[model samples]
Target chain A: EPEVTQTPSHQVTQMGQEVILRCVPISNHLYFYWYRQILGQKVEFLVSFYNNEISEKSEIFDDQFSVERPDGSNFTLKIRSTKLEDSAMYFCASSKPTGGNTEAFFGQGTRLTVV
Target chain B: AQSVSQHNHHVILSEAASLELGCNYSYGGTVNLFWYVQYPGQHLQLLLKYFSGDPLVKGIKGFEAEFIKSKFSFNLRKPSVQWSDTAEYFCAVNPPNAGKSTFGDGTTLTVKP
Candidate 1:
């Protein structure tokens, strides 16, 4: 089965540095999303993207966060400046936008660690 | 605010034992419910979902869940489990007409062989 794929399985960066988490969602999927799981915590939604624009976002997705589909296949989440609290496993997910109860597929996740 | 709550944080069961993971939602409106599982070293995978029709819904891996509207609950159950069933289970809910979903804290099941 085709699945979402994320790059840089493990990323470490300085607190004030920038980082980009990349994802290649299922080729045919129309909906994309970014989510995070702090250690021992429930997964939290960050943002959902569709038609090259943000469809929804959580409070945690503040000014510092931005997502873009720079190309047809890649969906990237960029954090302008990182913080200690930003450390978590970032997972990329995708689904069909047709919206008749479609299941979302998830990637293995990128473990972001800000020093 | 909409939220999901899973009552059991950790459960340890032996092979062939029955399993039940409690899940409840705070949303009082029409809702869609789902159960997802994450096995060790793997990404999260959907188990089952409830939209409408029969409250009893069966999912993959011989698992099933019943949605109780009045109780605001969707509990997952399996008559017998195997060691392969060891994983973390999450319950999620999306209120009617809402695009986003709220997820449970999750239940970690450890099935000993």
Candidate 2:
């Protein structure tokens, strides 16, 4: 089965530095999403992207966070200035449909550590 | 907002033991229920899902779940578990008519040999 792939399995950055997490979703998938899981916490949705634009985002997806589909196969999440609380396991997920009941395939997460 | 409730936080079992993990949701509308497993040092993998049709659903490996609409529950079960079954499991829910989803805090299962 086609799977989503994320680069930089682990990332360490200073509190004020910019960080970009990259994901290459399944080739045929049209809907992409970014989710985060704080250590010992439930997975939380951050943003959902479709057609090269954001369809929905949570309150945690503040001005400092942005997503871009720079190319056909790559989707990236940029954090302009990281905070200590930004450290978490970031997961990339994709689905062929954005409909309510469609199944999503999740990639192994990228662990981000902000110091 | 929809949310999932996993009653068990952690469970420990010996090889060949039977397993049952409880899961419930707080959505009044139709829901798409899912059970995902993340083995130690591995990515999340789908164990089972309930979209429609018969309440009883079978999935990968020896896992199964029964979606009880009236109870708003979708609990995962396996007749026998191996050490390989030791993993963190999450119960997730999404309204059948919506795009967003909510997941429960994971339950860590320890299977001893």
What TM-score goes with each of the models? 0.89, 0.93
Measured by DockQ, the strongest candidate is: 2
Q: Please list the residue runs of candidate 1 whose C-alpha ends up more than 4 Å from where it truly belongs after superposition.
A: A99-102, B95-99
Q: Cα miss at A96, model 1 (Å)?
A: 2.3
List residue ranges in candidate 2 displaced over 4 A.
A98-100, B97-99
Instruction: Give the Å shift of residue A67 in candidate 1.
Output: 0.9
* DockQ per candidate, 2 decimals: 0.43, 0.55
Q: Interface Cα RMSD for candidate 1?
A: 2.8
Q: Write the per-residue lDDT of candidate 1 for residues A3-76, one digit (tens) a residue.
A: 89999999999999999999999999888889998877888999999888999999999999999999999999
Residue A98 displacement (Å), model 2: 7.6
Point out the worst 10-residue segment of candidate 2 chain B by lDDT.
B93-102
Worst 10 residues of 1 chain B by lDDT: B93-102
lDDT of 2 by residue, A12-84 (tens): 9999999999999999888889999888777899999988899999999999999999989899999999999
Model 2: which residue pairs collide?
Answer: none
Clash pairs, candidate 1, are none
